[model samples]
Target: MEQSLYLKTAISAVRAAEKIIRRYWDDGFDVRLKADESPVTEADIEAERAIRQVIQEQFPSHGFYGEEMGSIRRDAEYSWLIDPIDGTKSFIRRTPFFSTQVALMKGNQIILGVSNAPLYGEMAWAEKGHGAFMNGHPVRVGKVTTLNNAALSLGNIKTLAQGTGWQGLGKIVSGVNRTRGYGDFCHYHMLAAGQVDLVIESDLNILDVAALSVIVEEAGGVITSLDGRQLGLEAKNVLAAATPELHELAREYLRVN
Candidate 1:
């Protein structure tokens, strides 16, 4: 299939998922804990199911990797990655920052990505080499070139403090001009919108960040593992920044010594 065909399919899939998610957003829903103790809701499962069904119906040959459902034909040349609700914790807490994320990977490259923010009324999507867009307007990363002037964003501080990334976290916090906890996929969307300069997070799967990586990069920012390497599905930590200069500085701070 052509890239455009896949991109349109992904957009339709996430939008379908978003409808399912919004229907259950504020009415109180049951939550369960996965093996990692992360919160999962009916919205998450149903949203993913709807997305998978939509994608599969149109492109049966393509693969799928989603948070709610595991891999299917994962080694195929083309695959879709879905995080039905990227911040289910926030969703359960009635916070509006949660979003539905989707990405299409053509071989090793992410060809298209979308982050649909149901409550925020923002939809960020990107096609490889075509740039990123928010609500149909092109967006770019901020112009903060130096860490001393950069606003650093983070996920759960406690999780950072207890993990192997604690030292790097300390380095980053000490170097940045300001720090905020905008946690989850929204921070990357914010980065793509040019509202944020840097975002660091520990412990995430491919479904949590594959779409974000493409969106951020197409928005003229850098997205990679904490070690400053190319991002991949296996990456657990992330460092996304507005520029290569800032990304390098962040990489230095996040480096394990």
Candidate 2:
């Protein structure tokens, strides 16, 4: 299949999973914990199945890696990475912050991504060089330009404190225009939509951020680790910003106290 066809297939698949997810939005069935203590529910499995079926039927030669299932790789040049419900704990608790994230990667680099927040009724998608869109409307990065005017957002702050300590975040909040904690990748969505300027994440799996890298980059932003390394499945400690200045400031905070 062509890149466009596979991308369309991915968008359709995420939306289809969204439908199944919305069906149990109010109440999920029998939540459980993964070995990492993260929440999972029947809804997660159903959504993954829905997405996997789409990929398998339409892009049989492509590889797949998803949260609910193990990885499958083929000799094909493209792979689809998926997260049926990125915030399952929140979803199980009836929060609307959860999303279905999908990314198409080739040669170790993501070229396309789509994120669907069904309950929120919005979808953000991007293709290499084509730009990003939210609900089909074009989206771009914000241009706060300075730390004093920058909006700083975060997810899993408590976990961040456990890993590197909140002192870094403390400095960031004091230096930024505003600081808010939305507690999931939704902040990244807000970043892609140009609502927020900076987002620092700590301790996430690839499923949490695979699609986000493509969306933010396409939206004219940057996503690197706190240490200034490029974001990859191996690096979940994300430090994302709407502009280069904010990224540098955030990186300095991470490097300092």
In model 1, the worst 10-residue window by lDDT is 156-165
Model 1 per-residue lDDT tens digits across residues 1-257: 23477778888888999888878975669998999888899999999999999899999999988898989998999999989998898898888888889999989888789889989788888998999988888999999999889988997556557766688778778988999988887789899988889998877777788888999999999988777777778877788999999988877765642
State the lDDT of candidate 2 residue by residue for 1-257, as single tens digits: 13477678988899789878877875547888889888888899999989989888987888888899868883468888889998888787787888899998887888898889888777888888888888888899998778899888877655778756477778888888888887566888899989999998786877788888888999999987778877666765788899997888777777722
Q: How close is candidate 1 to the true structure, as a TM-score?
A: 0.93
Residue 107 in model 1: lDDT: 91
Error of 1 at 193 (Å): 1.5
Q: List the residue pairs that clash in candidate 2.
A: none
Candidate number achieving the greatest lDDT relative to the actual structure: 1
RMSD to native for every prediction?
2.2, 2.4
How close is every model to the real structure, measured as TM-score? 0.93, 0.93
The number of residue pairs in model 1 that clash at the backbone is 0
